[model samples]
Target: MSTVVVTGGTGTAGRAVVNALVAAHHDVVVTSRSTSSVHGRVRTVRLDYGSPADLEAAFHGPDAVVHCATSFTGVRGGETELGRRVLAGARRVGCGHVVSISIVGIDRIPLPYYRAKLATEKLVENSGVPWTILRATQFHELVTRLLSGLTRPPLVLVPDIPVQPVAAEEVGARLAALAAARPAGRVPDLGGPEITTLPALARSYVAAIGRRRRVRAVRLFGSVFAGYHAGHHLAPGDATGTITYQDHLDAWVRTRR
Candidate 1:
């Protein structure tokens, strides 16, 4: 069996990828700073990208590496550093393929986070390691988290951010498939079924949770503008996912209930 190493395996998308790989009969090794949050049949290792030694040790004997680890809230400098460390470790261990998860419209959105993601993509391409990059749209869980508390009080200030919500499960499946295939420069974008707005999403979430909160759509110009002006940071054309936002909401509600 081929061994697959997944970075950030404790996270939402990373965990899903680990699950998918294990279910497909692949040997999965998960690495992250914190292993307490991860649960499954796969092996777990303690890792910190800050330490190249730890990273090298994790990469040892892995057939492929799924690079889902990211520090999205920071500027580009730190991400660049971490990307370099990851590439070095991958090379040291002679990993066959590296599959990276990135965001759509990173070129169009000039935010620090997107800039870092774009730079990492370039770094991966130039690392001399065969690689496949997948740029996916926003996750429905991320959107729901952002809108969770917005429906409080008298008025809810909703930014006009355009978003095409994607199910994390679909993205996870695609990532696993990419890891199992030959390296492609960049894969097609993955997005949800329909285009949606921030306010509409907030209302749907409030209803889903059976909350009696009222959400008023108030237009605001914030960092969301940078994310919104590019059409909600969504990929163009029809890259429809099998799961819908409503479907995601129903699932989340069922779990909570």
Candidate 2:
């Protein structure tokens, strides 16, 4: 079995990717801040990225590394810093293949977080390691989280923009396969099976949660929203994900029961 390491093995996307790797019979090493976040047969380790020795030691003897760790450090370059640490560790350990996950519209949108994501992507491409990068649309969980935050009691005001929210598990599965295979540069963008507007998604989320709120879609003009309005963030051409947003909601509700 190939020895593969996942950087953020406990987070939403990372957890799914770890599960996929385990199912594929790989000797998986997952990194988590808390030991309680890890389980199953895979090896779990804590990493302190600031310490070069600790990072190098964590990365030692891995066939491949799937970097699912993400920090939404807008404009400050913290996201790219995280990537730099990971790449340095991998290069030191001589890991053969490195796979990274990114967002689909980071190149098209000028939002601070998206800019940070794009910067991280550039870092991976130029890191001198055999690497593969997968840019996917937003995850269903993220969309729901955004909507939840916007819901202020009686009403939810969402952007008048379209979204394609894919399942984290599907993206993780794809990343796991990429991690095991040869490093092919940037792969096709993965997206949801359907294209939906923010207001519609918010309405569904509110209904699913049994929250009494009216959802409204308002147009907010900006370079960011313009990018969204132009559908630059969408992936209708690469809508390969199978899980629907409703499907995610149903499964989430079950967890709360």
Each candidate: what lDDT? Answer: 0.83, 0.89
TM-score against native, each model: 0.92, 0.96
Error of 1 at 115 (Å): 0.9
Q: List the residue pairs that clash in candidate 1.
A: 162-232
TM-score of 2: 0.96
Per model, how many backbone clashes are there? 1, 0
Error of 2 at 103 (Å): 0.4
Q: What is the lDDT of candidate 1?
A: 0.83
Q: Largest TM-score belongs to which candidate? A: 2
lDDT tens string, model 1, 1-257?
Answer: 57899988878899889878988888888887876333455888888787878988889998899998888555544776677788889988889899999888888766788888888999999998999999999998898888776776557778766778899888988899889888998888888888878888888888777777767666656664755755847875856787888999898989886
